[model samples]
Target: MRRSEEQFRILVQGVTDYAIYMLDTSGHVSSWNIGAERIKGYKQHEIIGQHFSRFYTEEDLNEGLPDIALATAFRTGRYEKEGWRVRKDGTRFWANVIIDAVRNDDGELIGFAKVTRDVTERMNAQKELAKAREALFQSQKMEAIGQLTGGVAHDFNNLLMAVLGSLELLRKRISADPRALDLLDNAVEAAQRGSSLTQRMLAFARRQDLDLQTVDLPGLVDNVADLLERSIGPAITIDMRFPARLPNVTADPNQLELALLNLAVNARDAMPNGGKIVISAREATVAGGDPDMAAGRYACLSISDEGEGMDKETLDRAIEPFYTTKGVGKGTGLGLPMVHGIMKQSGGQLVLRSEPQKGTTAELWLPVAQEQEITAPVRAMEVQATPEKRALKVLAVDDDALVLMNTVAMLEELGHEVIEASSGQDALGLLEQNPDIDLVVTDQAMPRMTGTQLLGHIKERSPSLPVILVTGYSELPKDFSKVPLLSKPFMLSQLSKKLAEALSSAAAAPDEDAAEAPAS
Candidate 1:
């Protein structure tokens, strides 16, 4: 029996993975095993006779938890807990600790036997796993939202195209009666608003098809200044500052313009009493970028207003889609989020700075282009009545009956002879038989044959003939942008503009592979 007891003592002293020690009745360390010395970062001589509370954190000691732990063990015979414990070196560990009351055979309390095991690795693993799960869930949710918004926006655009085109044509035909024209104009305006909403929806989902072009910063800013001031009202003065030279940016200028307009309107609304808005542009380069942008050289366009700003919570969620603070029907809650999505889609960033009572400043960072040759965009003409309307034979093709009829009506209203087809195959057949057809305007998403495929065949047969593809979807397959494009939900004025561009391309030397497309 004595030999077995000796072996037991050696076994207890040999272990080094845990801290095994004995505390006196007063909660002072009385004995320390080899494991206790190894795990607590202390020598047996250094730790023995010290208070057991020395192994507890400063916070735990202040709360008298060390004394309570001993009292509980003496009363209940055992105490067990998992928490952060301190080592002699002042480092912390997630420890699984247990203390048992030790008593003599006579049932009198003698001391306490304490055991501690480090569990930091296991705790860290659990936390990391939870974090990963949360990230995955967030990603899946955003993807689902993207798919839903993208599909709804596509269908909505197709309908808007039909509505907008018909309204524009109707407004022109009923011009004599002022009362009738005013009512028609109202309907047209409402339809245009709907079209704008659909575009914002697509923008929020990051599914708005982009028509990227190299644009000069100063020129673009100067061009939009008049429209910007007119929209913001007379109370708010506009200030513009730009350097003589700035790098051009690659972006969809129309979309960027709309985004800036949205910001301006937001600023106007914030300052009911009126305030000055500053529009500034300069060169910028960022390295190891923040969460919203990549590292690149950019043309920084900033819009600032001295008006009401946002608080922390509001600012944090400001860019979330459909989360507006404005009253119902007052705002769609999509302006900032759409701007955010556009900046990201364009490989740039949108940074908003605001304080509760101060004001707000929005910065649009657009990536710089490396190309030297800059092509000036064709200026859009706004003419209600053309002096000389082109009277040419045109082919209009679409899968949807309403949209096809709308296109045909607009062509007829413009005094062009309309040849209509409901499918790309039908349009192709018509083109082959009618060699004198001046232009072809077709829908993109047609069954069996797409607009691009038809354009491929048409180019092979008659490469020089002008053709325009109209669609709700802006994005197309690689190298499919050669034929001129007219975006869906367009007004008669837009239709007239694209038609003129196509008609003039016959005289000018165009890109050998691709035709210019409508940009937004």
Candidate 2:
């Protein structure tokens, strides 16, 4: 029975997953088991007499960890800890270790029993979980900011439109007095600047209308070469390695140029003392083999800077809205986020790679658009007259008093008779009174009834009446399939053009219009 008991103890000690061993009072390995061999990538012959400190990192060893463990075990009768430990192959692992002092009948220390378990996989999984949690938090915060920015941008655009529109009329009426013209010029410039700032906010919110087109990647880069050189001081060198032929990507040319400029400026900032920036372009195909990218032909544009790179934590949050490392007033923290939003809106992706000492690289992946589908020479707004006479009665609805008045004035200027409403409810009443109203232009967001709802009511009453929905908010309701939409703060010519097109289309499709009369 005694022999059998000893054999059973040995059998348990030989198990490979739980490393079992014995250490002397001085913390030197006295005996080793098969488990220790497997866990530490060692054999009994090699590690039986070695000091346990060999399993710890050099820093830990220098800190006298081996002696501390023995002292702790001696004082408390047992010691346990979990920390980084080295394996025989020079790899590090998370290890849970326990040491218990063993003594003889006389109460003299004999040895110590040690048990260790490899927990590296669990440690790594926990790290990954932490990263996922951080990413989720950032995404939620960005969504909240997006909603706030969108609303604020919408309101500001209405105000700017009113100011600019009134100015346009004033400019046309006033004589060319140098002083008056100069003052007007300044006001116009300020209003234009305000418009630009609002547009940037819209871009960050990903709500701006994109004039997407297929563009040659290299050509676009070349066009901005001079500007980039001027933007980044003469101390820094700008290098280009554009391929002879690159894939054409579908994107808004202006936005793409802005994105590139943002990236270049960021790169320049990183290199305060001046460094080289390499701009390169090439064609790439992401098949299933690449995990981060989708399967498609892509135009890859990369900007690399030999500057001070960001650490892991900073790089992770680099694209987040309002996250900037620069000093206050030095940065807005919206540039990279704007770039990210633009890429997402354009059906592309942006990725950043950086290391503490290895510098940084930003790559934009834009899916190649078909050559035939590419629009040539992007069109600007053109004023055209409608075939039908301007004698048609039009109803315009907007919550802003100034916007409504300005819109009415523009319509009257265009030789159309106009009826105005401060809200959707008022517009509905006017429409009910005059069923002969030829067109209904309504704002999307209003107090009582939304433009969408008002349009639905009107459609139900008269299917042939052309309805145009305008809003500073660009996103349309999902069900508004065939509805004509005009973005808010629009130029008078744009509004007139859109109104004409909607009316003409309605006139041509009388049969379909009657079938789907109600916009509900």
Candidate 3:
């Protein structure tokens, strides 16, 4: 009998080191130990016979946590959790808790054995770490976006300045005979093409207005075959493969074609001596496949090039903006990055596969549009008209002296009287002096005042004035509904068309003076 008593004392003392205690079936504190008093800030005399739920918060009590815990322990033979627990002083600490059912040998329920440990410091540290990580991620994302926006804007402006400058020069020299006029025409055409290219860049950068459509993937590829053949040169072979019944993808058809062309150009550059390029399309259902691919029907367009492919490091950073493997002046690192941005914005994904000396394949997965979402009569590019013998007053502005002079010359050659200004402020002054200014043409980014600011001022003063804004920047501030925009690097014809359109719209407006005039 003495030996059994000694063993019981040893067992109680061993459990005292671990905050071990006992609870009745009703969840009352049937017994307490030294460890429980140490951890919970309670004395054995003070806690014994009290409800075990005193260890829980008032919120837990209202939610019947004690009853739920007991029921869980009864059903599963144990209940375990790590959370906040109340102490004797009404303070809370992070706790690791375990409650085990205590049963007699005859299988009758007696009570529960409960154990707890304070872990507040560790829990708080973990929460702080998670918050810090989230903040860092957000900061990095914003920084990356800012860098991309700036790079795109700089490149766009440079291209526009070149085209617009050239067009202006061509306009001034049109009277230099038929040969000179032909050269000017060619220069203007090239500038116009450059403007189209910039517009594509803006589209990929998600800054352009998009007219989304349900596009037949195979048909689009087929249409571009002739253009691809001419653009890629005779050294490269072009091939297309498609399944008969492929799903239509929802996208801007022109943008999609441009994306394909960009990819093809990249592929062409990869193969200096030339190689075979294959364009293929197929329907795919990606359920439980790649995590990035998602679960849905997609139109998969793949472009493969036999060229000097890239390694793992290059491939990893390939989608990053301004990252290029090509030599200086050979490429703008925006090609693939723009493709990536377009895919992301279009509810799709771009996958690239490559290996050094092996070749490269880029796959574009676009979501399939529903039948009802498909619209009739796809939007196609309209043919522009040639400039006619018409004399009109025009106002043009740019920060660069050369660009300003060239634009003035171009407007004059188109049989229009040209007024030029070097800045928005100068342009505003010009507008004030010449109320007969048929069109308000201005550059976007400049010193003193921005193009958007000038546009706002002009709208306020002369709401009926046909204002045409030109920008080399990829991004425009919100609210551009009041004016027509012409991207930089435009041809003389492009300017003419825009001016014509602005005049048309202005003429269409109901004239208050006419309405007030005696019905003539």
Candidate 4:
């Protein structure tokens, strides 16, 4: 019996992964092994006579957890749990613990046998795994939302195109009737507003077509100063702090201006009692510093507002589409999301920082435009009636009946002979039957085959024939950008302009690979 007891004691002392120890009836450490000394950072002599509760944290001790644990073990024969525990040096670690009741041969309780295992690394890894899962879920949710928003916006744009085009044509026909013309003008204005809304939706989906340019940031802000003043009311002040010279940024000037206005309006709305909004700009070099932004030189345009800031929860979801804190009808909730998408498409990022009782700051970071990348702005010409150019036989194609009818009307109104097809396959068949067709205008999103697919077929049959691809969003493949494009919901004059440009360019540069396509 004595030899067997000695072997058991040696076995208990040899365990290095677990802190093995024994306590007296009063919960004082009565025995300690080598494992206990190594794990707890205390010698056996230092801990053997001390109270075992010393291993508990201050919070646990205040809760009387050690007494509860011992009582539970004594009554139930064993107690097991996982929680935070403290070592001798006062550092906390996740611990898996077990306390077994020790009793004499007569079944009277004497003390407890305690065992503890450190599991801090395992707990940390579990937390990291949970975070990764949450991140993946968020990414997938956003992608689904973007896809839905883009599709709906594209369909809305087509509807707006039909409404706007038909209204313009009717207005022209009834120009002499004052009442009729006024009503038509109002209808046109409403449709134009809807068109603008769809554009914002597309922007939020990161699918809008942008007219990118190297813009002078300070100058653009200066131009909108009066507009900003009128928008935010007299109570609010617009403070601009820009240096004398700053690097130009690559962006769509109109869209960037709109994004700025949206942010400014958001800031103005935040400060209901009136406050100063500060707009500033500075140069920054990002080298793996921010996870959201790429490493490059950027012009950081910051807009800050003195208002009641958002809490962490609100700030975290600020860029989610359709999430708003404003009263009913006061906001659409797409402002921040649109700006976020625009910044991303422009090779930049939008960052927002806010704290309770302080203020909110929005940073619009844009890539600096190199000197060679800057393109001179084209001078705009006043819209006028189409010039007396030679009329050509035109093929207009669209799957939507309303859009197709409106497009045919516009083409005939411009004095071009129109032959319409409802689908790409039908258009191809028509081309085969009519070799004399001079040009083809097709909507990009269609059934059977898309506009680019039709253009490819036409290029194979007749590379010199002109083709104009019209779209509501940026759906064209990058390589096909060289093909002429006209945005949807276009006015009569815009369509006329696109037609003339396509024809003239085709004539001027016949050898350009993407300039011409076969109509027949």
The most accurate candidate by lDDT is 4
Show how many residue pairs clash in every candidate, following the order shown: 3, 0, 2, 0
lDDT of each: 0.84, 0.84, 0.78, 0.89
Clashing residue pairs found in predicted model 3: 160-489, 168-406
For residues 1-520, could you state the per-residue lDDT of candidate 1 as single tens digits?
9999999878888888988888999989887888888778889899888998888898898999899999999999999999888888889989999999999999999999999988899999999899789758765775677678777887888888888887777766675888888888888888888888878878877876776789887787788889999999999998888888888898888788988999999999889899999989989878883545677889999999999899988887787767898889999888998898788888887889999889999999999987845776543443333322759899999999999999999888778999999988898899888989998998888889988888888889987888888877666677876556788888777787778877766546466234665554
Residue 300 CA displacement from its true place in model 2, Å: 2.2
Clashing pairs in 4: none
lDDT of 1: 0.84
Candidate 3: where are CA atoms >4 Å away?
A: 1-211, 229-245, 265-278, 282-298, 305-309, 325-332, 345-347, 355-359, 370-381, 386-389, 399-402, 420-433, 446-450, 474-482, 511-520
Sort by lDDT, top down from the best: 4, 1, 2, 3
Which order, best to worst by TM-score?
4, 2, 1, 3
Q: List the candidate 4 regions with Cα displacement exceeding 4 Å.
A: 1-11, 33-40, 43-48, 174-183, 212-227, 238-250, 280-300, 367-373, 377-390, 511-520
Instruction: State the weakest 10-residue window (summed lDDT) of model 1.
Output: 379-388
User: Over the stretch 296-375, how does candidate 3's per-residue lDDT look in tens digits?
Assistant: 89988999999999999899778765678999977767788677767766888889999999999999999898873456
C-alpha positional error of residue 453 in candidate 4 after TM-score superposition, expressed in Å: 1.7
Candidate 4 residue-wise lDDT, 1-520, digit = tens: 9999999999999988889999988899998888887788889878888998898999999999999999999889999999888888988889999999999999999889999888889999999899889878877887888889889989999999999999988887775878887888899989998888788778989998877899889988998889888999999998999988799999988789889999899998889999999999999999985657889999999999998889999997888888899999887778898998899899999999999878899999999988624576653454343443778899999999999999999999989999999999999999999999999999999977999999999999998899999999999999898888988889888888888878876777756654577655
TM-score computed on alpha carbons, candidate 4? 0.86
Residue pair clashes in candidate 1? 161-489, 482-514, 482-515
lDDT of 2 by residue, 1-520 (tens): 9999899778966698989998887778888888888889888789878888899999889898878988899889999999999999999989999999899999899989999999999999999899789767776787778778878889998998788777877787899899999999899898887777677677778887776888877878888889989999898899899877676898888889999999999999999888999999888888875544568888889999988899999998888767899999898787888888788788788899999867899998898987724566444534354535566688989998989888888777667889999988898889879877889888888887888898888878887788888878666777985688877676667777887888877878877656889867
The clash tally of candidate 4 reads 0
lDDT at 182, model 2:
96
Clashing pairs in 2: none
